[model samples]
Target chain A: MRRFSAYEWVRTAVTIGIALALGYLVLVFTVDDPNGAFKWFLWGPLSRMRRIVELIDYTIPLIFAGLAVSIVFQAEIFNIGAEGQLFMGAVGATFAALYFPQIPVIHVILVAAFAMLVGGAWASIPAYMKAKWNASELVSSLMMNYVAFFLGLYFINYHMRDLKAGYLVSYKFPETAWLPRILKRYNLHAGVFIAVGFVFLVWFFLYRTRFGYEIRMMGFNKNFAMFSGIKVNNVVLYAQIVSGMVAGLAGAVELMGLYKRFVWQVSPGYGFDGIIVALLARNNPLLVLPAAFLVGYFRTGAYVMSRMTGIAPEIVTTLQAVIILLITAEAFLEFWKRRKIIREAMKAEGGDVQ
Target chain B: MNEIARSILSAEFVYSVIRVSTPLIFAVMGALLSEIAGVINIALEGMMLMAAFWGVIVSAFTGSAWLGMLAGLASAVLLALALAYFHLNLRTNLILAGIALNLFASGATVFLLYLISGDKGSSASIKSYVLPRVDIPLLKDIPFFGDALSGHHILTYLAFAAVVFVQYLIYRTPLGLRLRAVGENPEAAESVGISVRRVRYIALVLSGLMAGFGGVFLSMGYVSWFARDMTSGRGFIALAAQALGGKTAIGGMLGAMLFGLAEALSYTFQAIRIPSEFTNMMPFVFTLIALAVYARSVIARHRKAPSSSQPLEENTET
Candidate 1:
């Protein structure tokens, strides 16, 4: 009992081992050629430079969403409204892009910035209430996600709907308003750099600054922080608002960088995925890089997998749900079981001090 | 202003309230039981979605809406078992476990839909039995209230019955005491020879059963078919009702009715030429405002005198 038991490590190994086995089973059952499908699922994305660049492009919004969720989670707020915020941000940017299409190129940045502002403001409503009134953010934020969805649909159907086009979508956004592709050959936009910069900024804010320290303290024990004279409410509110801003910007990036027009019927659940990413990263900003990549890779591969194997693209979603369940459960149960055995052994040994 | 006042007071508005409140009643009651037993069951959305799907699927097979209701309950109980066991025994994060269940339910239901119908959007094409409406002959004798009570689905009456049932169960029964004790103070409950773990498992199972009925009501009672994620945000709204009601059965019911009213108005407002989307956001917007107002009142109360079982600490401990 003194040493780390072999059983504990085996459990950890088994969880991951089972996850891989499930993935392989899915591929084998779903695909026409299981052997070839295995290679595509694991290694196909790494085959070419363009595919790698495409991976970065796909990873951009996910990274921002991950960082956003991580920031809020650090303050112990579960902002399930990430999808809602992102949708609003996209709506804000879409309106700006459509109406102010004649504005200068530099002014478009302001529009994009305003989209972030609006998105953050939208999320702030829930955060403010949760901080002040002891409201459940998980509930309010999730409800807001639907509110965002229907509102976005309304905008596209009425205000931004292109009469020229037969579909219920906005008019084509002017090229000037479209974010510049950093690589001419690829769709990789300036959003990648922006995502990376935010990652560093978040890491610095969380680990280095007093505000970050306050957030972590509040997250760990709100009463302890309150007793220590930290404004627990303000810290939680700030974390949620800032998280909303990052997620909001991700929406703007997705709208401007990838689309010719706003066509989303609902937020693509990026914010929901962000929760899983944040959990996998253990709420560490720097750790979000690998976490986001794994998610983005699976997402990118899922499309190809579906095309190649006839498996639905949502298989990755199942993988994500399993991974989060594993991570969240692992630490607590291990601690509880180990602590129980220790107490029993100590009682048997007369409970002497070391 | 006069038109707005007229719209607000219309009979259509009352009808809307009844329509929306029906699902919220199921959801809030489900949330109330589990929350009282120390498990935060946020998987209401997933449970509702699965129940809705199963309800439609089962009705299509059996040609009986009652069987569909039973199927929905069965599906939810299975989910409850997974969530309850994992949270209680494995000491997993209940919220995350709820999230996992929700994710799994959403994907698994959709996958099953593909397997059954080969269509992705909805199961409308499948021949499904609709839940029969219950016309109360005597209740219709009463004036304004009778109209509200008459020609409602069976589940609607069941929802009202559930509120009274839950109230009695929690406030008057021994099982209720054990459930509340586990939630209020688990360590103390354990010390008193009550199985805290067992209480939570029972609460979750019951919560799932209630939520399952809610889901069946959606497809069989209301729509007669399951669309993808058609439970939509009702489950979350129910969670909001639980919060607003302060986890009490009556409070939860009142909060749910209010939300239902807001939702009903949102639809009614659409008839009066108001943009449907803006009206749809009414309940959520109201929830935010209510939350803010509630927060201010709590702070005001705190200033007067600190309450025992502080908000931050009461729910924080595992």
Candidate 2:
């Protein structure tokens, strides 16, 4: 198993290298100053301590979202509603922060709890539909995202709109609900600790628990798990709800740790980014940390590159897409493995003749 | 109440419904074809966005809507071919590949738009050719129906015609039989000399073409320019429509119309002080409800007669 994993690691590294080279070629074709663009894309984040700190801050939600997706994926449920759940979490946290300004330490805790509850509630609808009707959670969860987005927009535009603000903005979150920054100089907050803690917690839960084993079994084969007396419906429901709660917590953390108010026009695609992170990590909770950081580093560097080079930051998105496509192409790895096996067999035949 | 009734009953409302449903109908047809062939083309959203962007750019450059549409179709087909190669030949997870492609389309379209137009939001500066609206000569003279049916873009009429075409192709052709056989049991079909991969490729290509038409209509017929992420969630809505339609072409059309009506009603409702957000959410919420209801009915039927004909299992593989 270790040798196979090492082989998989090598294959993954090679795929990533190829994807990056292709992306650089695309940049060369599109941009006049390809060298400058490439420099900024590859090294801008590492060139500054502030940028590195920002990358760390951005990776917090990514870690949570990755873990969220990995959890549901383990149960073989495609609950893509993390995007919606995150939005709903922001809404919940904002509501709590704005409405209960009197409470100090408790207010922050309450807001976090509310975010998780709202996120879980949002996911439960799709979970219910899937459990009861065998309806495609993929479709329902996806459709629900728009509803959640628009609903969040409505709340910000109407109910919580700060009329004095020039643009559409929500009322400032109360000071009492603010999460303390760990590194005040760089604006890093306590959420990073929570994110790191979740890595170990999720790893333990997925690797050591009986429930996690059931989830893994179900993911491996639903019929076999069902015949083995696993209650598939309840497991699916629990997995989706827990996944949503984690995503919701990410939103709440982002809001309290970064923004002063509800200013999100649309989800920043953190949920989708989490999907890629989970995929890169092969759904391993512990591996999600490095995966999220790698993605965050790319994003930060891309942002700086676009700012410096007058290119759109969306170039990073294109690169991410290429990486995802290459990584997920199963045949690429298999083809190479087959060739290696054939070569080894030929060598063995030659040795026997000698 | 009287205001609601007046707006709902107006000829303009019916026209709006038809106009709104046109692109959705195209996407639904595309999704239905792919789903029936056991390849769920969730990349319809990306394909539509790519076509929409290219269709507008090409029309702007060439000064011809037809040429623009051909370019759009070609672009979608190219993406579809890539999807087929990666998913079928490479044995990648189809959903993951589709998602990646959708992300690629979303970013690439905006990136390309910015490079060419110097604007990330839209292509409003470019003067693109719009598809001409056609009024049926004899039909335009009809009393009540004239106002509702006449003077729509040519693509709208084609959308309806394509429904009939798709239905005929899927039901009456030997190709359709082989496609269905391949989807139901690929090994069995292979033994009988049907190429499953080839059928899937054809289905994906046809799906891409229909999605291309939808994208072209969005840019050229619905509006004269492409906006970033303008296809919005319509592609996903079409997927819902396909599922709600039970994988039948005609039913998909009806489902698309229902969503279109919801959108049109939302537009009207906005004038009456209803929150546009709630109205905007109606179609998706309605889809969820419709799906649940459909599932319940199917379950009830199963319980009533265990050995009865299974109607909802046609596209359950994905």
Candidate 3:
């Protein structure tokens, strides 16, 4: 494991502090009740047990989504189709749930398997193109996202739509298909345990296994990995498929855990939010849980704050963008780091002017 | 079936195709310039969205379409410069920065819309100026072609004019050569005393300017108002068009037209029994197929001449 220096920690804290300050400043200018907005923004999620449970529920899928993106990113494949993959996953799970309404344990297993299959299949298209033609996975994945979204919409609107609901939503799953809620009063479900389990599993897969080592090697230097007989194309393909499976499972989990029916708008930018979560965690699987929880807390707080103060919930989105921009900036603390290095070197060379 | 055929053949449908394609043409042209300059301006969506909002808001306030266009252009250019700064100077990951900017634009535009017009869905509460349409004097006399070609928004005409201008600027100008040089071989260009960063910045700014026109047209001409996420996925389609066109201005225009044709057909199909979702999926599916075919052809051509080196090989790196 690599150790983070004090300077690194300070810089991260300072950057986050600056981002929060800027967000608060925007709130003060736009919101009528700045103090209340700020208060909710900081602590609303923690204010009530129910809200805290909702935050945990929200974080469950986010953890999986983050892990999905992180896995593909580690293999240096820019797959932005996680959103589409998740949509497909939901579609697959919905089909399984609606069709096999009996045999509770078997039904849940089949739903998850179908979700993984659909998501992995959706992702393989771009992965195949990248492996064979060296076509950009980014563009292909993005294009596939729209395709998946529309396909999912078509399935729901034409096949599964519940006419009695007065909205474009799917028929409700049988009670046997629903994942049990962990907390009786709150929204918390068994999916949170699965999410935590996967975090450790992914960490093990990415670090302890030979395939994981090869993925890391390929990401570090594709040419070197190729020369070292790592079968770069296969690795890329597998990494993408695995990533898609995780994203698909996230979608399935979200559906089973929270909704009785497959809602038309299944994703509220969960895939994109995963990107931010992964980046915040420095693409470390172990860090994804906490990072996702942090985002979940902020998102819940934003919802509470907006509801109370009439401020748009999009304020959280703006804050997220600002934070991402600041954190990704390579030049943010380079000068300070360089100065520190120089100072240390000078101290080592004291009284030895040659 | 006869009615469908008649509608498809009518000049009105052709005119609609051109009108729908106008914004895409501008965006594809922008994508072409930036891609050639080695900077993938995926933030085209964000820039266009910001421009669309600002253009409508400014026109509503000023009652001048021209001023609104300028405001839109300025706003897009500002965003482009910021993208260049973060990607080039600050050394941020370009794709991540673009995505961040897009998220920022998506949220900020709606926030600003709510703040100003008190409506998050659209700027329809404000009476925005609509861009004027121009009919070619002599061209209007031509029977079949006249109806299809004349009486378009001035920006639509400018979009076509931009195709030629971009073609000339890229292939015939010294700046174009330098930009291409900087993109193709930055080390060689630097050794020859070219400022790589400066060229990239200029390309990005020009790209932003073109995309700005597209955005202004979306609000001021296409619909006369700004809606949340109005540009939709046109920006991504433009990028796909750039890819399909082989990063050339004329090719990009043709690609944009093809996608526009698909979009126009989707609209037509909506009137028929086809589900709107399938129709909506057409352009993206078309893009994927186009890209796949383009990639396959290039690969085939390379295989055909295995030993011979091609000058254009470098352009295919993207």
Backbone clashes in model 3, listed as residue pairs: none
Clashing pairs in 2: none
**Per-residue CA lDDT of candidate 3, range B188-220, in tens?**
999999999899899999999999999999999
Candidate 1: which stretches are off by over 4 Å?
A1-17, A23-53, A99-105, A331-354, B1-16, B140-146, B308-313, B316-318
Show the colliding residue pairs in model 1. Answer: A133-B295
Candidate 1 is graded, for docking, as acceptable
Q: Interface RMSDs of all predictions? A: 2.6, 1.8, 2.5
- For residue B149, model 3's alpha carbon misses the true position, in angstroms, by 0.4
Q: Report each candidate's C-alpha RMSD, comma-separated, in the order given.
A: 4.3, 2.2, 2.2
Q: Is candidate 1 or candidate 3 better by DockQ?
A: 3
Query: What is the fnat of model 2 with respect to the true interface contacts?
Result: 0.70
Q: Please, what are the lDDT tens digits per residue for candidate 1 over residues B159-267?
A: 9999999999999999999999998889999999999888989999999988998898898878888888788777777876787787679999999998887777667
Which wins on lDDT, candidate 1 or candidate 3? 3
In angstroms, give how far residue A110 of model 2 lies from its true place. Answer: 1.3
Task: List DockQ, one per candidate, in order.
Answer: 0.45, 0.69, 0.58
Poorly placed runs, candidate 2 (over 4 Å): A1-4, A339-354, B307-318
- Which ranges in model 3 have alpha carbons more than 4 Å from their true place? A1-8, A346-354, B306-318
Query: Which should have the higher DockQ, number 1 or number 2?
Result: 2
For all predicted structures, in order, the TM-scores are: 0.89, 0.96, 0.96
